[model samples]
Target: MLSIVPRHYFLGFIPLAAGAELITVFGVVNKASGIYGLLSIFTGHPITAAQLVLNIISLILLPVFLYALHSVRRQQALPVVAFSYVYFLDMLANLAFTIYFSVTWFRVFDATATAEAGKGTASSLDTASERGLSITIIVLALLFKVYFCFVLFGYARMLVRKAGLRSDNGEGKYMKQLQFIMLAIAPSFWRRGGRRAGKGRMVNTLEEGIEMY
Candidate 1:
């Protein structure tokens, strides 16, 4: 398993595991609220398929998130590992939805921009700036999610190793694949290199394990 930081730094992975669950719960709530807001404002219109899917997912996972949060707080091994896998898969799903929505938004924006350009109401420079800002936000969000995945999986691995769980015995090959995907998806991660353990220097920080993965 890839180590995001020294083993001792995680304090048995309790804090990170609990924090991950809490963050996910909040995220699900936020998504639910956004969906509700859209529905409220567009009461006469049928909701899009994307919104329906997101609503169902958020509804289904909210209870699961709560259960996982409870279990992780008790330091349960299975739930921690399971939640890590769920979070990783959710990250991929979020990526797919993000791409779909981004493409859809750009298409609609392009049409509006064209119309506004003809009307002399909006400039191409303003459109480009908006696009750039949206893309930047999306990229940053994905990068942060990628790093959080590492932290979560690292914590899960620690828990499994501690509990002597053989359920993850064949995970090494899959983990290599995951690492490859991470590197390919976020090449800019390579530029964030920081301190490393070498020359008798003790490594105990998250930055120290950036290259270790």
Candidate 2:
């Protein structure tokens, strides 16, 4: 399996992958809001109870995202590895939830389309196009998630490698397991582009001279 080490997170600048981590924090906020909505739904009826539980589990795992972000800011190696693992797992859980919700949404939409068509207010062609658009958006979002996971795991690998950590050490072995799992789950398309980040270039340019005393 090929290892993915991105050259830069966005564009040709932004040395570290922390930008993605920050974006991930916002994503977690969105997920938490979504979970709240799902919980509300569960209150009215027992529907989607399983999704509620899965989302709660995912939310419970999110504190590490914050912890890891802080550690990455401090340039700590081990905690970054843990952050990478939490991110990978969170991506998987979210993928499952996204798929389930998309399917359920389409089912409900189809039923609604049937009702509207019976009243001659909805055109079948218009409904089909709308459904197609929704599918395209979902696919694009999932692809982005896969690529984001690649960026995160690569960033962690870069830190571990730079810190002179031995692969036989506990953290190293755990990271290797994560890499293996990502390689198994990620599609081939996720491997293309963004590997140009040079070695030792991860430190932000703005913070370059602050450590000297």
Q: Judging by lDDT against the true structure, name the best candidate.
A: 2
- Let me know the TM-score candidate 1 reaches against the reference structure: 0.66
- Give stretches of model 2 more than 4 Å off: 1-5, 34-47, 169-213
Q: What are the per-residue Cα lDDT tens digits for candidate 1 across 46-144? A: 777896786667667667677766766677665666676677888898899899999999999999999999999999999999999999999999987
Q: Write the per-residue lDDT of candidate 2 for residues 28-125, one digit (tens) a residue.
A: 57656646756677478555676667767756756666676677777776677667667777789788888889989999999999999999999999
Each candidate's clash count: 0, 2
RMSD of each: 10.6, 10.3
Q: Which segments of model 1 are wrong by more than 4 Å?
A: 1-18, 31-42, 168-213
Per-candidate TM equals 0.66, 0.69
Residue 201's lDDT within candidate 2 is: 39
Collision pairs in model 1 = none
* Model 2 collision count: 2
